[model samples]
Target: MQKRAVSGVGLGLRSVHYDHVLSRRPAVPWFEVISENFMGPRGGSGGRPLEVLAKVRREYPVALHGVSLSIGSTDPLDFDYLKKLESLASVIEPWIVTDHLCWTGAHGKNLHDLLPLPYTEEAARHVAGRIEKVQDAIGRSIAIENVSSYLSYKHDEMAEWEFIARIVKTTGCGVLLDVNNIHVSAINHGFDGEEYLAGIPVAAVRQMHLAGYSEENGFLIDTHDHPVSDPVWKLYAAAVRRFGAVPTLIEWDEHIPSFARLQKEAAKAKEVQDGVCAAAV
Candidate 1:
């Protein structure tokens, strides 16, 4: 499939805002859709959701973000899932296809979580091999996103950033830098967020995710339920400075507000990006 360039600020295309987005045609430069939601029946085209997605695609660029690739799982890769994903990509023609770097489940059971992976060379190699297989199946490069974590592995051999960089280097996949996840992981693990950013290869970064997190019992949670916090906004500025106008998306999956509220958040991102670019001159 051909790649498209997604510029400016974008919004996650939630069902709640379908009417508003399709009718009003908001100022969003692009929209990202969850891949699994549009996978229709076997040997068939996507259903109503895909129809709506096509409408949105007509007005803005779209990117496919997935949650269940299970790239880090021990089980054999799911060719069925990959086939569906490829079919969706063939239709959407997204700028990029992306999923979390962490695994979802194994043993034929869907864990329904973006579980962390061991930051070891062996683990990196294993996941990189899986990523390559995924890219080959999809017929294009896919970006792997860093996920937030509340725990660390005892057998980890390197820092999270190092592991991610090594995977990108080995597999030639792009990085979807989620600034909120970096901040949440940094706060939970007591690491410097800027240092994490510094360790990553900036050129591999293809897109960015900006979302809000909640604090509970002195621990931060990657709950995409609220507005972008001030600290996340600041980190996003740093990301824009480093990545130079990468496509950024506002992800509010839980307690989703009205379309206008989400558009306001996208506007805020554009404002911050504009300020950062202007100051660089």
Candidate 2:
């Protein structure tokens, strides 16, 4: 297994704060970037974004988080996309590479959304096989994150946590546990977030994601627009206790805030992490 290079808390690197981060060089341990944004024709090594990313990388570790891997789709694996992703990885050498467990498209059509998959034995085997192939293609293991869902399939034979656990056991891939996603999914589908946490194998989790969500018409949306909710912070505390200081990140994608605001939010995660570590001792 690859050693974890990132620790403590981190903030997602947004283009809005590129200048601030590059100029000031904040003390963030690492930054997670959307993989697709940097896969330019030149493999992103020569683009302006790549130049900025190179500067950030000189100061901090980076992780590649992707949204369009489509590992769960029935369509044939897109080797061309995988090749480009491999090239980007070669340049960046991210501490970790990851994508969502849900499928984003099907039948050569880009649906442009992280669609949920059926939680069944067959689905688990299929996704795990694809992940294995992806690892071989990239020449390294990758983490898979869970997506928040508003609906469930009637044919699901297992719980969401069970599905993820099975995938990890089968593929030997790490888990990027998204705390906000767990809370949103639990509330929307009527389950306990703590139960979900407990069901996951602690050793399989390599990283954790903390973000904010919004409520609309009684359903909680994974908006990542506001501050981390109090409830999600509590869940994060639980996760820290269970996982023992896994690399954590604060994700704020929409309504991008000032670099200072983002740093303040990251500071909160650091506070929680320090408190948890102290209590553990």
Candidate 3:
């Protein structure tokens, strides 16, 4: 049997320079689209993004990266939100669909952020149950990502990696291992990044996210608003060494750079991945 194609370094699909992407059509292995942006028919500004996405989907394989799954919330699973996701998946036919493991909001209020979940058995069970229901509803497996957190929950009973491993075991879901986020959390919480990477089940990882961050008051934030930092690059190098070049992405949500600049970042990831592949030989 032939080996399955995995995702390599790619960019987050943005509305800016949509034509440039289609025209130049750079050597992107796979593209990741924000799930909510393309979920439905557009009326005003919203529709154009989906139109471009449809064209891009025809050109390259796309993955779904969601911001608002709210997997950790105690509230009932939002079937309406998930049905929309299912509908969009049918249209775009993504390579993978994933969301953060943390909750976004509760009681119908949009917090507009990825809030960390308490690392306890209770939180694990709650998130795992939700992930199962979501996979069942979408008729596809989903990957969960570890978000960069500032503060740790005092009430939590376990480490982040332990919680993540348990969630994967219970739900049988894959992981979108963000190397940058792990580094950020490790630096903020004072843990070994290598240990965090080693604790994860390598076979469970389907994709990886590498992005830049900002520091404030001796804490690292997953800003995704700047270029890839040297520390993150070091971590990325380590990740490919450990995980064998899992599909990686360069995410820049703010201070958006030109497509050429983003592709440069992709090349960096490719360089590291190639170095790893070479070392194994």
- Residue-level lDDT tens digits of model 2 in 73-168: 999998978998898888888999999999998988979789999999999999999999999999999999999998999999999999999999
TM-score of each: 0.96, 0.96, 0.94
Question: Worst ten-residue run, lDDT, model 2?
Answer: 39-48
Q: Write the per-residue lDDT of candidate 1 for residues 167-188, one digit (tens) a residue.
A: 9899999999999999999999
Candidate 3 stretches greater than 4 Å from native: 1-4, 40-46
Angstrom error at residue 56, model 2: 1.4
Error of 3 at 247 (Å): 0.7
Q: Model 2, which residues run further than 4 Å from truth? A: 1-4, 41-46
Quote model 2's TM-score: 0.96
Local distance difference test, each candidate: 0.91, 0.91, 0.87
Which residue pairs does candidate 3 place in steric collision? 7-247
What would you estimate as the lDDT of candidate 1? Answer: 0.91
lDDT tens readout by residue for model 3, 151-239 = 89889898899999999999899999998999999999888888888888888988899999999888898989988889888888887
Model 1 ranges off by over 4 Å: 1-4, 40-45
- Summed backbone clashes in each candidate are 0, 0, 1
Candidate 3 has its poorest 10 consecutive residues by lDDT at 39-48
